[model samples]
Target: MFRDSLEAGARAVAAHFDHVLSDAADLPVLHAMRYATTGGKGLRGWLVLEGARLHDVAPERALWPACAIEAIHAYSLVHDDLPCMDDDDLRRGLPTVHRKWDEATAVLAGDALQALGFEMVADPRCHPDPLVRADLTLSLARAAGARGMVLGQALDMAAERADAPLDLQQITALQAGKTGALIAWSAEAGARLAHADLAPLTAYAERLGLAFQIADDILDVEGDAETVGKAVGKDAGRGKATFVSLLGLEGAKARATSLVTEACDALSPYGHRADALREAARFVISRRN
Candidate 1:
């Protein structure tokens, strides 16, 4: 059920992107923007739609923010895969944007995607209330900017340059920014749209985000490139500190399981209506990629 919903959300977001960018000038950067947004789990967008559904927001109203978050996510991946960043060669089983095209094109594509994300959130289609649109835009800016994801990425790069690897606490804080920030934003988006209390979803996302990173660390240790659709064991190869590195494989897995439990527990207020989100937490730990 979760997989079906996830795929549906992915298709919805992709179609929206296609419609929005169809009239964009025919250029390599525009093509790269389309290519970079293509293919992924679309987990962030799914979270937006599901959370909005839980809040009784109409699907049409939810779709705008859903695609907006996905665009932001895609832009992050494009920049993260650059030679100056993770320097990855593959993403979603294909060449990274920087590798498929030039670094300049990849940078411009990411920049455009980021701008498009903000534009989507601010558009009247996202929410009729201008205040709601402003809130979404402001929150997304914080999530994707220096105070959040960018902070995490900068810390990661700094850790690579430091003489010593980051300790467990440092890595936790880093991952919170690098990955958790956006996921938290995605999970909390519906509540924002509906003007509901944000505490419960915030709590849910905090635990889920950490668990997601821990699962990623575990996959880096135990998964294959073919299954994971990217390089495996990169953390070990680089001697980077990760959940698995600090806690050991079994301990890391245990932590993730416990976190998933906590994440589900956080959604108790929503009762069975949140069952799919609970399942999503479980799937995060079990997914091959």
Candidate 2:
């Protein structure tokens, strides 16, 4: 059920991108924008739609923010995979944006996607209430900006340059910002749209995000380029600190399992209605890529 919903959400967001980019100028940058947004788990967008559903918000109203988060996410990946960043050559089983196109085009495409993300959430179509649109726009800006993902990225780069590796606490804090911020925003989007309390979904996403990163760390140790679709073992190669490195293989797995349990527990307020979310948490730990 969770897999089906995830795929459906991915398709929905892809269609939204297609429609929005349909009339865009036939430029390489525009093509890169579309290519960059294609194919992923679409977990962030799914969180938006599922959280909205849980809160009784209409899917039509939820989709704008869903696509908005995805655009923001794709932009992040494009930047992160640049030669100046992780220097990756592949993503989602294809060339990274910078590899497929020139770095200049990749940069422009990422910039466009980021702007598009803000535009989508700020549009009145996302919510009837002007205040709701304002709130989403502001929150998304923070999540994607210096205080959040960028901060985390900076920390990661600094760690790579430092003589000593980051400790567990520092890495956790960095991952919370780099990876968890957007996930938290995605999970709380439904409540934001519905003007409901954000506590439960926030808690769920906090744990889920950490679990998801831990799973990534584990996969970095255990996965291959063919299955993971990106470079694996980079952390180990770089001698960077990660959950797996600090906690040991079994310990990291145990910690991720514990986090998934906590994430599922946070959804108790929604009872069986949140089963898919619980499954999502579990799937984060179990995913091959």
Expressed as tens digits, the lDDT of each residue in 172-275 for candidate 1 is 99999999999999999999999999999999999999999999999999999988989998999999889998999999999999999999999999999999
List, residue by residue over 1-289, the lDDT tens digit for candidate 2.
8899999999998998898789899999999999998889999999999999999999988889999999999999999999888899999999999889989999999999999999899888889899999999999999999999999999988999999998999999999999999999999999999899999999999999999999999999999999999999999988999999999999999999999999999999999999988999999999999
Clashes in model 2: which pairs?
none
Candidate 1: list runs displaced more than 4 Å: none
Taking all chains together, each candidate's TM-score versus the true structure is 0.98, 0.99
- Give the alpha-carbon lDDT of every model: 0.94, 0.94
Worst 10 residues of 1 by lDDT: 13-22
**lDDT, candidate 2, residue 132?**
98
Task: Tell me the RMSD of model 1 versus the true structure.
Answer: 0.8
- Among all windows of 10 consecutive residues in model 2, the one with the lowest summed lDDT is 12-21
